[model samples]
Target: MQTGKIGVTTENIFPVIKKFLYSDHEIFLRELVSNAVDASQKLKTLAITGDFRGEQGDLAVRIKIDEKEGTLTISDNGIGMDAEEIDKYINQIAFSGVSDFMEKYQDKAEAIIGHFGLGFYSAFMVAKKVDIITKSYKEGAKAVKWSCDGSPEFTLEETEKESRGSDIVLHIDDDCKEFLQKSKIEELLNKYCKFMAVPVILGKKQEWKDGKMQDTDEDNVINSVAPLWSKSPSEIKDEDYKSFYRTLFPMNDEPLFWIHLNVDYPFNLTGILYFPRVKNNIELQRNKIQLYCNQVFVTDQVEGIVPEFLTLLHGVIDSPDIPLNVSRSYLQSDANVKKISSYITKKVADRLNGIFKDNRKDYEEKWEDLKLFVNYGMLSENDFYDRAKDFSLFTDVDGRHFTFEEYKTLIKDNQTDKDGQLVYLYATDKEEQFSYIEAAKAKGYSVLLTDGQLDVPAVSMLEQKFEKSRFVRVDSDTIDRIIAKDNAPELDLNETQRDILSEAFQSQVPKLDKSEFMVDVQAMGVDAQPVIITQNEYMRRMKEMSRYQQGMAFYGQMPDTYTLVLNSDHALVKKILSEGEASTKETLKPILSEIKGLQARQTILQQEQGKKKPEEITQEEKDDLSNTEQNLSKQREEKKQVIAGYAKDNGTIHQLIDLALLQNGMLKGASLNEFIKRSVNLIK
Candidate 1:
């Protein structure tokens, strides 16, 4: 036996390993099991090269947990380290045996996982002491045992091992006894080694015996030696892919489609990316794409590896080229990462395009589920946008779908405005915006259903991409004004009549929370609704963007502003205006006369002030102008209050306002109750 201090620059390395080696202490199992598998694979490589004349028996990596003894052992039947090799690989903390093997057999070696050689030290995180019993495959080689007790001091001695392999025994620490539990170890194996290249055996297979689960003699393998992503796409059946998907996520719905990624030219990447059915909640679908390094699970938070939008996809991505740190918990920034991202983006776009081209009817059938993913990709990645535009679809409220170019061709003749811009009309809620959609359809315009979570930003991005095109919500404005081909008809009412009508209706508008209304009297046809509520497109989009974007919370805090458009040609509005004028003309006559005199003085004072420099103007002149403006505002407000008073008692005005609110799904609670009662009374 030979005992000595571990060759190290500092004695504090063991403490660092115990406390800060890994973010999670559970990662120690993954590290140890991965090392065992690497040894097995290295033995296979040597066997293939005719370097070893040994029998390649069961290469399965087995794990055993002794709860009473408080020891968890991971054993492998493969090439093991002799005393000399252990001294070189184990004593030297950072020297990697896998790296040395790869340098010699780069083309022949099977998936070798170790790189930093720090994986062995991760055992100290949860183990008070660790023992390695190994026997080399070389002829006449001696078995060796290495013991370390969570310190730089370690012992190396001769040991008896019948097989040519290694056994890593972890004496779990008192605070880390969870590693000794069978269920806990099995969980770690499932998460970190589910798709490992080597078959991993956890324990005996269980059977229901005498109304309870009992361990049988059969070995229970926890990992698949060859996952679906590791196979050729041609060899995999559609049902097989779906079965694998169910194995990955048992609770999710059936995927719309999947893309088999197998590229070796630019960078080594292989995986299956499934396009899951993404509904309204985009956030719930993130972090599903698992990243693997040579089939060893690295992480599921593959944010920088794939495009941000592709995070919505669910599947596995295995690539040896992706750079990782010692822990392999986080991805490191590298040029290969960006290359992989671009390659994945291209593959996704290509798969979508292929599906669209091959079976457009089927693509349309799946569009409802695929819209969120495609829209997100187009909105977030410009390169993806360039490729996705051909396959991305625009679904109308009538359940009809069209590609961007196809929709452009279908509507270019009629939906083009006088400015030669193609107007794309869309609606968010089909039932709530039914009236607006009908109005747009009456004008022979198709209205798309832009109701996805990302549609707000996606529409904005499309506006920038489409040439001379704009996306307008069907309820954003009157159909005639939204895609105006001719000048609007003039209103018959004068300015005072229009102002009175606006004020009267505005007074009757419901006081909704976080909402403001601006009354606008338009000369819509007599058949049009008396009142229609529409939101400003830019402000509404900004508010919607605040839900998904950062640094835009100010828009979310602002009150929702809507335009209450009253058709001047409609009978109800005309009658209201006529009655308001008849009732308030007598009271507003004196006020109007006073306002006119104050306004004349105000205009004269403003013109005089504008001609003189700020220093030349007298303070008394400024006061006179200010006084005239205040008086004029006071008289106008008095006239409005008189009109508002008349409107306050008018149930017709209140009913019309409530009707518009109801159409937009904004009338709620007490206000909605009031509208119902008033509607019944008016009917009676």
Candidate 2:
């Protein structure tokens, strides 16, 4: 027997590990169980290599809880360390100082176990005292028992035999009795060791007999030694991939498609990535991709390994190249990590392209489900954008789909504007913008459905990617204005008459909060709607961007500005103009005649003065010019008042204004009620 203090430069190392090693205390189970699996695998390797002459049998790890004895034991038939081996690996924890050790591994607590030879010490965190009983597999090896309290001192001696390998017995502290509960150990094993490459047995399998669960002779193995991700892609069938996905996420809908990743040369990476139905609530499904080291589970928060956009996918990514317990910042800065991200991006794009080229009908059927993820990748990753554009599609309102190149070629002949730029028309809400879409279709123009959550940002990105192309919403303008092939005819109304008609309808428009309108009269064909409401593309796009991103709050805060266009050629607009002209003509005629005479006199006086030098100009001439200008200003005011008087009580003007508002989904609440009542009265 022997007793000695642990060999450490600092007085002891246990306190340092307990304080700075694990921020999450529950990871202790993962560390201890993982160490046992590693030991078991090592023994198997030694037997295969002829280093150990003894038989290699039953490498299964077992976890047992003795609730009455208040202890938990993890036993494994693996390589067990003699006293000298234990002293080299465990006793000598070479610590310079707490600050130095912490500074070295501050942000990397997860990496400490395998990298720093501290896997066994993690048990001390939850156990008041721990005992290691073992007989090494090496020839002439004597069985030994090692015991320690939570301190620097320990006892190592030859003791009663165990078959071989080691047993780690933990006398759990009062605060950590949760580890002794069979259910608790089972849960931790399920989480961290579910995919480990060795059989981990927790307890006996249970059967429901006599209305209760009882143990059977069969062992309850808690892990899959060779999970689906570790297998070759050719060995996995589609249903097998789906079965694995269902196990990973049982409550989720079956994935639309999956990409099997298997790369070996520059960096070892293997996994399966599933493209789930992400059309709705993209933010809800993010971070479902898991990252693993070899077969050991590392983290589901894999934003550092997988690109931010691909985090929407679900499945496992195993790579021994990436450190299992590194900081996110460290992971992101790794060269291997960058290569892994680029490879994944290329792989996903290739898979999508293959599916599209092979069975376009099936691909189109799944486009609605795949849209959010594809758009996100294109918008976030540049290389992904370059590849995705080949297979990405545009679905028209008629439910027919076309590739970007195909659609651009189809529309370039007629839809290109006078500035040599092609115009792509789209609709967000097919139901609300139904009339606008139909109007566009009437003119032989196709409107696409860009209604997904990411479509707003995607539209802005596509415009930059496609050559000399722009995307416009169907309801953003009149059909002719949205994709202008030729100049629209000008209205024949005079300036004063135009003002009179505009004022009449503008005054009757409902007063909505955070809304503004500017009225314009256009000579559209008589068949067009009498009044149409349209929003400017620039402001609307900016507001849409503000909803998902930062730095555009100013645009979001501004009122929605709409262009209220009144068609002068329509019979209803023509009637309103005629009625307004008749009612205000008599009052405005005398004031207009006076203003015309005064303006002619002022023009003559200014011309005569221009012919003379500043000092030579007569004082009487200056007075004449000043009086003419004042009279002209006063006359314009009187003319405006007469137009206002006729506009205040025009019923036709109010009805036309409401019709445009209702079509655009802008009319609501008390104003919508008023519009309904007035519409009923007009019908009567």
Candidate 3:
């Protein structure tokens, strides 16, 4: 027997492997199991090429545990090594056995997956002493044994062995006793090797035949030798895809559809992507797409592989081009990764367009669930938006769906404003904004139910994409303002009359927390509601967007401002004005006469001094003009004070304001209680 240190420039390789090689030490099992699968695959290749004139035999990689001996062994019945082979592949520290083997037989070994030449060394992370015993497939070969004990020193000698493949034995360290547990090993195997190409056996299969689980004669195979993604698309059925989806996500809802990605020319990528039921929340459904490298599981954080919106999808993406150990910085800079992202975006768009063109009625039926994903993609990726423009759908409150161009054609003549801008009216909440929706529909206009969480941001983007188009929330303003065909007929009241009625109605407006209202009088035809509450669409949308974006937090903190529009043409408003004026008319007649006398004097003085220069005006004339203006202002205030006082006690003014507040979903708590009580009293 002869022993010497590993062929390395530094003695620190073992220490680095133990403490710093991988972020999680549990990955050691994955590396060992993958190496075993690679070895078995190589033997199969040699058999197919007639290089070996013997049976391929059972290729299942077996894992065994000896708790009393404190050792775990992974054995494979594949290509083994002789003494010279061990010295060249195992004794040399940095050289990879699989790398040179692939170089020799590149065409026959495509599934072999070993990179960086460091996977075998990772066993040092959890083992104190590791052993390798193997015998070559050649006609006359002797089995060899190699052993190392957590250091550069190793020993190689001839050993008697009956098998033809390799056996790797690991002596568990005291610090990593948790790995010895059966359940822990099973979990790691399920997560990383669930889809491996070769059969992986852990122990004897168990059955609960006699009220308790007992080991049977059969081996417990733990992996799927042929996953759906590795098969041809022509061999897969819709039910097969759905079954695979169910396997990946056991608790998730059934997927709406799936896209099978199979490409070889541009950096081989093959996988299945499913369009899950992604609605209501975008953040909750991310990180569900598991990324793999040559069938070995890598990670679930695939934001770099697919676009941000496509991360909302679910299923597997296997590509040999992706480096096994991925870094965020590398993913951002890798050329192959960028091409994969672009390709995924195009595939998603093409699939959606195909579905839309093939069966539009079916697509429309599923739009309620599909809109969120499509809208998010269109709002984020520029290329996706360019492709999705033709197929993206719009469903109105009437439950009829239309494409962007189709909707434009449907409402172009009636919904266009005087400035030739097409008005796309939408409502965020059908129940809360029902009156607003009905009001629009009453005017022969259509309203879209833009109630999705991402709909607000998407509408902001559509404003720039659609030609001469703007999306307005149905409840943001009155129908006249949303799609104004002509300037509304002006209110027929004078300035003082307008202010008096405005103040009267404004005084009855409830004080809601985080809300402020400004009163405006408009002549909105006799059939319109007496009082309507409308928020500015621009400010409202800005505040909504600030909920998702970072730099616009100031808009979220600002109080919601609404316009309290009082219709002058309505009888309730006209009656309030006339009655308030009538009740105060007797008291204001003499005040008004004195104000008129002062105004007449001021007009006479102004005419007399019309041609005079500033210095020519006497002090008495200036004092008289000033006193007349002051007295007139005082009299109008006294008159308005009386009228506003009467308006406060009037039930009609309070009722109108409360009804408007209730319609806008702003009336609640004590304010709502008070309105209810007041409403009851007025009916009594």
* Model 3 residue 13 lDDT score: 83
Q: Against the unseen true structure, what C-alpha lDDT does each candidate score?
A: 0.90, 0.82, 0.85
TM-score of each: 0.95, 0.91, 0.92
Tens digits of per-residue lDDT for model 1, 1-684: 999887778999977765665778888888999999999999999999999878999898999999999999999988998999999899999888989999999989999999988999999888889999999999999999999997889999999999899999999899998888889889999999998888999989999999999999999999998999989999999999999999999999999889999999889999999999887778889989999999999889999999998999999999999999887877999999999999998888888899989999999999888888888887778788888888898889988888888899999998999999999999988998999999888878899998877787888888988899999999898888899876767678888998899999887887788999999988889888999999998899999989888999999999999999999999988899889989998998999889889988988999999999999999999999988888888888898899999999998998888888888888899999998898888789
Could you give candidate 2's per-residue lDDT for residues 431-481 as a string of tens digits?
A: 999988988888888899988888889999999988888999987878787
lDDT ranking from best candidate downward:
1, 3, 2
Candidate ordering by TM-score (highest first)? 1, 3, 2
Output the better candidate (2/3) by lDDT: 3
Error of 3 at 352 (Å): 1.1
> Model 3, range 550-646, lDDT digits (tens) per residue?
9999999999999999889999899888987778777767877887787798788788878799999999988988888888889778766766788
* Stretch of 10 with least lDDT, candidate 2: 323-332
Q: Write the number of the candidate with greater TM-score, choosing between 2 and 3.
A: 3
Clashes of 3: 0
Best model number under TM-score: 1
Give the top-scoring candidate (lDDT).
1
* Candidate 2 Cα misplacement greater than 4 A, ranges: 94-113, 326-332, 591-641
lDDT for model 3, on a 0 to 1 scale?
0.85
